[model samples]
Target chain A: MEYETPLFFHVMRYAVRADRDVIDMVSGNPDWEPPEALREGLREYADLESSEFQYPPSDGLLELREEIAARRGVDRDQVVVTNGAGEANYLAMARALERDRGSEVLLTDPVYPYYPGKTTLLGGSQRFVAAGEDGQLDPERVREAASTDTSCLVVNTPNNPTGAVYPEETMRELVAVAEEYDAILLSDEVYDHYDLSGTFASALGVESENRIVTDSVSKTLAITGFRVGYAVFPHDLAEEAKSRHMLINVAGSRPAQYAVLDALRETDPAYHEANRELLAERVETFTGALEAAGAEYTRPDGAFYVMARFEGYPGTLENVEALIDDIGVAGMPGEAFGDSRSDWLRFALVTPRVEEAAERLAERFG
Target chain B: MEYETPLFFHVMRYAVRADRDVIDMVSGNPDWEPPEALREGLREYADLESSEFQYPPSDGLLELREEIAARRGVDRDQVVVTNGAGEANYLAMARALERDRGSEVLLTDPVYPYYPGKTTLLGGSQRFVAAGEDGQLDPERVREAASTDTSCLVVNTPNNPTGAVYPEETMRELVAVAEEYDAILLSDEVYDHYDLSGTFASALGVESENRIVTDSVSKTLAITGFRVGYAVFPHDLAEEAKSRHMLINVAGSRPAQYAVLDALRETDPAYHEANRELLAERVETFTGALEAAGAEYTRPDGAFYVMARFEGYPGTLENVEALIDDIGVAGMPGEAFGDSRSDWLRFALVTPRVEEAAERLAERFG
Candidate 1:
């Protein structure tokens, strides 16, 4: 009855204190500076009126909500700023349950594991639809799985682990299924800006009354620690979202909100272009090493990761462990994400030493 | 069934867009600057390794937890850092419910309004124990209320709304009751630093296996918007607390954690002393005006609020509305806190113009 894997922490703890040369790629922590405008924003916020730090308006500061609304093409009241996309997802799922929307939550196999955990915490059941090779959602299969008891469907595009950037047609079909079944479609589009593939479409773009889009300044701005995110809700669910937000975390981080507000206003489109380009180069270099090692990998269309299978061995937890201990290279096991794929190992090319890590893997696997 | 009142926000919202001269005694937001050490800390954190901006460790930064643990006299593992005490309390209550510890959550009648709302959200029923005349707990009343089905009891010392700082003997007896019934005792000591009557005992100071202490820098440091707090759970419950925290909010504000760490390291005891002194002055000035106006009220021992009843008026929402519209002053009605008090109005002494607010109240009531 005790669920105690510590999830991603179990994979990263060993490498945290290891020698500096050890290549740690088990987590999604970005390796880049946030926009300079954020730091400049912090300096200005530090001198605001003393009461500026009061319990911020529970839904969020109006100014920040206004900005999020403008960016998403929603009204200010439709936005509920949250601690992170983490909390935004929690609020959405909890709302679905609270309103008797459904006790059954739907997810994709090879899922971001945290989705299942959040569903469990809120006392709801999860049923995942397996993705196609390289993590593409099969819209027809998803539509088949829809039922009256399904309360929610979660889609993470520019998806994690498999790294597929969902196409607009697929996204439209997903939204249609949610609308047809009267179930909530909760999308975590925090990585929308990092659409390495130009075909990525946001649920926010093709609006439906049942769609709830959760996003954060974290991935794009590289400020995950600041904990400022938002959920755009259907107008009907907006009040519930606000109340639930208050009961859960009260409000998002205030200083982070101000900093992000400034960053959003001042950040040049070129900043996002540069980051996308950097990820593309890393993906090419690391996947090339896998190809040379005689390993089979699915090249990702967007996110900075590739899923590969080492020749002569499946990617089990033990193999992941040995890769760390024997080669000083760490990676996430596919099984850690979902039960569907134990043969695939997930590698994040987030570190500057991706080439070295790939060379080490090629030395043994080749 | 729709719990629409956003509590603290309902009080503060009216004044938010009002004239600058409007005195808002509706919120506990302090009218003072945080320690200068926090600003200097920000400057240092601004330059940390780029990965520092990535997701923080889910439970919290080890260094910050270690500091909180040392100060609270608990081991680092017992602390689960959360997004403000809001999330800490949510995790604790949800854990209690998830384990089937009990079906009901107990609270003082004049409770912090947020408690009942949280218990409801987690699918648990709420039971109330009415406070004594001055909003103090009579150990016997609480002991008599205890039952095997009571999953948890929340005691906020320097109680919000009433400001009753529970006596050590009362706290000890309350813990004994929870021990006998084997129910969790959640002590929210966020306001302990504001103890004016000098009688504050942490539930941590009295050992009990079924207890959790939720604290935060928000109230003490005057930065509720920072959204960083922690809960110390029984060793057996620590894992559940961590999992629930991750599922709810991932981690608290990361940059705030670093800044608070530096502030914790450099803050002089003199700083807290000065803050306590200022609250003492505000309480005196405001309450003196209450007495002169012939209003019936109970003085608070800690925290920065006083409960008073204007002659011929039963502290209803309508009365509060009149106060805001007629006098440009805002306050919370006691009915919002609990159903037991329909005749008492709660006024926070947080405004810098406590004297002016008091003068306005006296002119109208006297």
Candidate 2:
């Protein structure tokens, strides 16, 4: 398989060392304070006994997994803490493929590149079904695309690049399709807390053994550096995922998990509410600037990204670099995601300078 | 592949909540203080700016990589920091299989179970070459066992379950066999710091493009929960490994890496030397007790594990549990390693109560 490294880091690196100033809308690293509790937790961890510095339970610290399970309405046995949602997704996909129902992974076009990338890495064939223009996947289209050969279906809600939160009905229908095709529905809800529309539905709510949900506090808790995430599998599949996780990572960072657990317990709902409000405002400002530039764009309903199209400029790597060099604005080339969005540029509004980047884009493209 | 979960955790968990005071020789968790500098680093991290808590460079923190490169005598670009030595070894194995030389992996019998577990996880076939009774691999046997079908040779110096530090000449011959067979040589030298014998040889010392060495401070620093480790690849293989690392895990825990980097720079060699001395003392004491029990045991030349065969007691799941229940001591069943040593049991002498556990075993089995 070709090693198609994700381009987020590549573009971010280019923007970083560029001679001119570049507003980084390229990567998803959050530009906000993590929960105060998280820092406090880390400080507390430093004083932990020597044995506490050894490995946590291979699945995770039992307390954290129990907390995650309690919140997600699952048993603790169903949760396997992972390095991040990246590994969570990888484990979910591996479990799906390992079921031997099929070797083809069904993904959406204009997908999170890592989804297709991981499928290929795990030696599974990929089949893409394009999402609608507003970035919502149609269950009918997915059903049509899937067959007995479809081992898994990967969907990211409050999705990346194109932030569409699937409705509860869509999630149910997707689960039905997965059930009918004997395929696992792997839902990545890492952007769960970024649901500006409040219409986001979790696969965990779907009553199907065929569904697995992967999530992380990376975005929610604003602790991407902590590298803590988890997957909720059906009880039967949990053992294999845990085994895979143990073999792959042994365990997540105990300090990170401890911190995340403390944050989860101590941080108020207002913390999440405030971040959502902040992202909601950024979306309004950024999309309004796109309107000023007379560029076509999809204003995100969820997550912290906006996809825009300029009149004559296609979102190629060359165009992305040109914008970085010329306009001092950096965004991901949509073609890097998949062919469907080849003419669009996706910007992560994760920086405090989102408005400034929007102004830069409007002034130049306008 | 039947999800053969590594038995270490299963046995450890059994002992943890067992009805008695079981001495935990089952797991390799070191019972020692991590460097004071590491705790200081975590406290320092809690005070860093918010952006500093964001995702680190996918490969690793630059200073950490540079520090590792300088110490290991490899180019900075040749190193990829991983979740732990576990992920480092995973990445190396993935790269070797991706090279498509062959799908078969050559491993040592009486092996670290994770090596074969990883081989199966990666969809590769495994072939084992038995080690000598002293728990050391004969390079001639390795060369005789390897074929063009073998894509990689995974060896651990100061190895797990059996502490066999490869001599410089043995490492040279293993590299030669890998080079001759067009196989990648993946040497896991995680126990480099615990080399009780002065003759421990690193694959990095061999100038072969086929060589990849994986190491971590989990044992040396007694901070397994930090989950920071790295792999040094041949310059040509670095990119693919990095890409795989990124996809499998977006990044390692930034705080853990930051803290580890601090400890690496600030902690004196005395910390490591002191640890080695402690383990050497534990080995002498534990083995002496084993001798009193009239058991045939391999005295480790390096690493912390001791394998012993008790007369009339074949190492098996039931026997391991019986030993734990009756004698209140825990050790891994040798059959968990491979058929080559099914009659033996492996004990990790990493706890303060090693002497007590050793006494219990001697009294019961003698």
User: Where is model 1 more than 4 Å wrong at Cα?
Assistant: A1-6, A17-20, B17-20
Chain A TM-score of each model, in the order shown?
A: 0.96, 0.99
- Which pairs of residues clash in candidate 2, taking residues 3 or more apart in a chain or in different chains? none
Judged by DockQ cut-offs, is candidate 1 incorrect, acceptable, medium or high? Answer: medium
Model 1, A1-366: lDDT tens digits are: 344243578778766655555798887767867889988888777777767766777777788899889988899988998988988998888877777867998999988888888887766888889998768999898988888888999989888888899998998999999999899889898888888889889898778888899999888898878888989999998888888888888888887888889999999999899988888888888889999999999788877678889866777778787778788988888888787778888888778898998899899889
Once superposed on the true structure, which residue ranges of model 2 sit more than 4 Å away at CA? none
- TM of each candidate vs. truth: 0.97, 0.98
Scored against the native two-chain complex, candidate 1 gets a DockQ of 0.69
Residues B1-366 of candidate 1: C-alpha lDDT, one tens digit per residue: 365344567556666766545778887777788888887777777677777778888999989999999999999999988888988898888777776767989899998888888898777888899998788999798878888888899989999888899999988988888888888889999998899888999999898888889999998887877888899998998987787777778888887888889888899988888988998898888889989999987788998888999988777878887888778778888888888777989988877888999889999998
Question: For every candidate structure, what is the RMSD over all alpha carbons to the true structure, in angstroms?
Answer: 1.6, 1.3
Strongest candidate by DockQ = 2
